[model samples]
Target: MKTKINLIFPMVVMALFLFIGHTSAQPAIITQWTFDDTIEPSTGEGTASLIGGVTQHSATMSNGWRITDFPEQYVGSGTAGAQFIVSTEGYQNIVLDFGHRSSGTMSRWAEIHYTTDGGANWQVLANNNGDLTPHDVVYPFSFDFSSVAAASDNPLFGVRIVSIFSPVAFNPEAPDSTFAANTAYHRARTPGTGGNPYSGDGNWRLLEVTFAGEAIMPGGAEKLTIVDFNGGNIPELNVPFYLTVQTQNINNEPTAIEIDTEVSISVTSGTGSLNGTLAQVIPAGEHTLSFSDLTYDVAENGVVLTVAATSGMVLEPAISEPFEVVYPLENIIAKWTFDDTTEPVIGEGVASLIGGVTQHSASIGSGWRITNFPEQYDGSGTAGAQFMVSTDGYQNIVLDFGHRSSGTMSRWAEIHYTTDGGANWQVLDNNNGNLTPHDVVYPFNFDFSSVSGTANNAGFGVRIVSVFSPVAFNPEVPDSTFAANTAYHRARTPGTGGNPYSGGGNWRLLEVTFLGEPLGILPGDANCDGIVNILDAVTIVNYIMTGNVHPFCFDNADVNSDGLIDVLDVVGTVNIILGRVRK
Candidate 1:
C-alpha cells in the first residue's frame, strides 16, 4: 500500500494513502442525484433513472421527496420509498450519500440495500436508526460498500430505500412503484388524521442522493530499471554490450485496456546514447524490450552510467543511480594528492599517522607539515611523513617538498631504504644535489627513481628523515631574518632549540606519486615532442578511431601500457596534463 498502493496507490488525489485492497487514491464523487427535477420521468444530473418512486413533480418546488399520512392511529405494517436507481459497474469501494427526516423515532429503523440482479436479492447495507425525528430535522448517514462489491460476481448494482415506519413492524418493498407511506401496516403514533405531508413536520423526506468510488484504476506506472543484460553484472570499461530493458506501462494504467503511450531511453556518463521514441502498444501487464547494441564508455574508475527513462505522460520517468563498470588498473600502483583530505582520492595505499604530521595548506593540492621530526626513527614516529611505499626494483618515489633553514641552525632531510622493514637502512637517494641545507625551500621534487634499490625485492621500503643543522639568521624574532622550514613553520625566535625539536621549524611535502618500473613513459606521449602533452594523446585517438593518422611509436601510444590503444589513452593523457602522473 505505497498503504493504499502505487502504480494505482491503493495514492489518493492528495498523496493520501488508503487502506484499500491495493495502493490507490481515495474514492471521489463520480455522479450524484438531487431530486430537484421539476420534470417527471427525470433523466437527472448523474444520468440516473427515477424508477419505482412516488412522483411529487413541481414547477415551483417546496422542500424534498416526501411521503404522506403520518401521525395517525396505528395499524398493520406499511412500506414506501422514492427509489433512485444508478449503476456501479467496473468500479469499487463504492459509497452512497443521502439525507432524510421523519415524524417518529419510536418506529423500527428503515434500511438501505443493494441488488446485483435487478432487485431480486437485496443485501442490506446501512439503516436509518441514526436519522433524527419528531422535529423532522435532516441528518446524515454513510455505508461502506466494499464487502458487498467484493462478494458480487456482477457489476450492475441498484440501491433501494425501504421505510418501515408507524406501528407496523414489518419491513417490505413498496408495492410495485407507488407511494406506501400510508400503507395499512405503517401507522403513526399520533392519534389524529395525518394526510398532508407538508402540513405536519413528521413526513419522511429524501433530500439528496449521490455516489462516489475509487475507480480501481491505477495511479502509478511501471518503474524503469535495468534488467537482463548480456554482459556480466560487473561492468568492463570501453566494452560493447547489449541489454534488454523490461519496459512496462509507465502510466501504471491497466493494460487490460489498450492505449497509445510513448517511451524514450537514454544514458548518461555512458557511450552510444539512444535518441528516439517507440510506439509501445502495451498489454494488460508487464513486459520488456532490448536496447540491442550499446558501447560502455571508459571513465574514471568509479564513474557511473545512468540509464534514464523519460515520458510525456502522467507517469514519472525513472532515473537510475550510477551503475558500475571498470577496467582494473595496471602499471601505476598508487597516486596521492594530499589536498588536506585524509586518504588518497584514487589510490589504495597506507598512510601512517606519526609524529605531529598533519595536513596543511600549500601552494598546490595539500601538504603535510612535518612538525616534531622524532629526533630519532623507530620504524615509526616523527620520521613518518606520509604514505609508505614498498619498493620492488626501480619503484619510483616522486615527491614535492620545500626546505627552509638559516645558517648553523638549519634542519636537513635524508632519504633511506630498508629491505628488512627499517632494520638494515642504507642511503637510497638524495636530491639536494648542491648539498645545500634547505636550498629548494618551497616546492621541490625528489626524483627517487634516479636511485635504484640494492636488492630486487618486495619488502624493500623507503623513508625520508630529517637531521639538525645550525644556521644563523642575520636577525631573529619579530624583526624577521629567520627562514621557514619546507612545511612553513618558522624557526623559533632566538632559535632556543624549541622544545624536543632541535629547531621548531615546519617542513612541507605536497605530492607523492609512486609507479612501477620502466615508467620512462613517453607512454601516452605518441609524438615524443619531449613532453607528453595533449597533442600526443590526440594522435593516439586519431589512429584508433580513423586509422588515417598514426602514433610515432605504438609503445608510446599505449598510455596505460595495457598494450592496447583506446579511450584509456585519452584518460591517461588527461591525467598527465593534470599532473596526476609524473612518469
Candidate 2:
C-alpha cells in the first residue's frame, strides 16, 4: 500500500514558483504528409496526431479533395503552395518520397521546395522524378542538409511543398493564358515554387516528406521512467531476469552518430543494489542491461533502480528518476487506518499524538486528521501529530500512507522517527526535498528498512515533527483548507539533498501500514541487558538442568552461532566474557 509518517506542524507566510512541473519526451517525427489521410487527427491535432507512429496530416475529404493530375498538367510559376510548421531542433536530413502516375518529362514534373523563414521565400530540394515509378524503393529519395540543420545560428525548420506542373514557356516565356488556372472549378492547376496555399488538389501526389537526422538528446534519453514489465503481466518473483531499458531516444538519435558511450546502473537505496558499467555503442534504440550475471539479487520485496548515462561527448551526465518495482510481500506486521479510531485499523497498534492534531475530514474520507501542519515555527512545535510502532521481529519494512497538503512550496513538512524511545530522531525522508505537488491528496509509499534501529524492537516508537517554514503569507491560521490535490509533492527538509522549499508546507494526514517480518528470536542476552555475557551462560546452564527453556535471538546466544546451545555453549560464553574470542 501507500505510507505516511509524522507531520511537520508549521504555520507560515506564502510563496509560489511557476513550475511547468518537469520536462517530458518530445515528438520524434515533426510532420508526415500521407495522401491517404487528413492533415490532422481528431481532437489531438494540436500536438500532432499519430497513426501507427506516423503523424498524419489532416485527411481533407470535404473542402480540398481531388485527384493527382500527373506531372504533365499545366502548372504555375514561382515557389508558392501549401505550408506547414515543423520543429526540427536536432535533426539534419531532408527525405522525400512520392508516387507519380506517368513516366513524365523531367523538366515538366513536380518539385519539393523548403523555407526557413515563415514563408516569404522558398528553395528547391528535389523533384518527383526519383519516385516516378511508384513506390520504387522506400529509402530511395533522400538529401543531406548537414549545412542547413546543423547551423548553430539558425533554428528554423519550415517547408512548403509545391509542384512545377507545366512551364509558361517551352523555351522563352509563354503568355499567362498558357498556364493552367487553379481558380477554375474542376481544372487541375499545376503546383510550383512561390504562390498561395494550394486549395484545389491535383498533380503528382506527395507521399511522405521527413526532416530526420541524428538528434543529440541530452541526459541518456528523455522521460526516463519505468513501466511495468510486460504491462504488469509477468510475475515478479524469483525469476531470473534482464531489465529492458526502453531508450526513449529511438535510433533516430539513440546515441550520437559514430560516437560510443558508457552506460551504468547503480542501486542508491532499497532492498536491492547494483554496481556495473557497460561499454557500448548503441546505434539501435531499445537496449537490455543484464543483472542476472551482475549478482543483482533482490528480496521478495521491491527495489528502486536508477540508471545514468555518462558520456564525455556531452557536458553533463544524464540521470533518470528513481524507478521503483514492488514485489508484494505477504507479511503485514501492523496496520493503522486512523479511520475514526486511535487504534490500528488492520492489525493491533496505537498512536501517541500531540499538537494541533485532531480528527477531521482532512483526508476527505472519515479518518484521523491533523492540521496547523508544519509548526507555526520550527523546533519542538514542529510536530502536528506523532506515533510509536513496534516491529516484533520484522525487517525490510514497507511504510505506506495517504497525505494531502496546502500553501506549501516544498520541504514544508518532515517525518521523524526514533526506534529507541525518542532518545534520538531520524528524518524519515533522508534530507530536504519536495517531490510531491499539493494540487491534491493521495497515497504515497517508501521502504523504511533503511532507517536506523528500526527492526525487532517491541518498543520501537516514532515521532513526526513539523518544522518551521515561511512558504505562505496571510495564510491565515491554517484551517480545513489544506487538503486533496489533482497533483502531488510533499516538502522535505532543506539540505537533505532533496528539492528545497521554505514554508507553506502544511499537510493533512491519514492511513498508515507497516509490512515486515516479526523478530524471530531474542539475542544471546538471556538477561535482556542488551548484551551476552557469562551470566547468560549460567542462565542457559540453569535452563538445561532445571528443564527451563526459551529462545532469545538464539542466533546471537549461540556464541559460536552453532546449531547447539547447551553445556557445549557454556565454554563459548566464558570465552566471550574474557574477550578471549568475541561472539
The lDDT of each candidate is 0.46, 0.42
Off by over 4 Å in 1: 1-26, 39-53, 57-62, 67-79, 103-108, 130-132, 150-155, 165-203, 219-583
Q: For model 2, give the 10-residue run with minimal summed lDDT.
A: 9-18
Per-residue alpha-carbon lDDT of candidate 1 for residues 130-227, written as tens digits (9 for 90 to 100): 23433244444455677774422234567766554432233323221223344433322222433333222234655445566766544344454456
After superposition of all CA atoms, the RMSD between model 2 and the true structure is 19.0
What lDDT score is found at residue 326 in candidate 1?
39
Q: Residue 89's C-alpha lDDT in candidate 1?
A: 49
> Per-prediction TM-score, please?
0.28, 0.39
Clashes of 2: 75
Candidate 2 lDDT over residue span 250-363, tens digit each: 222333322343455566555555533333433434433333323344432234455455552331223434444333344566666555566775555667656545444333
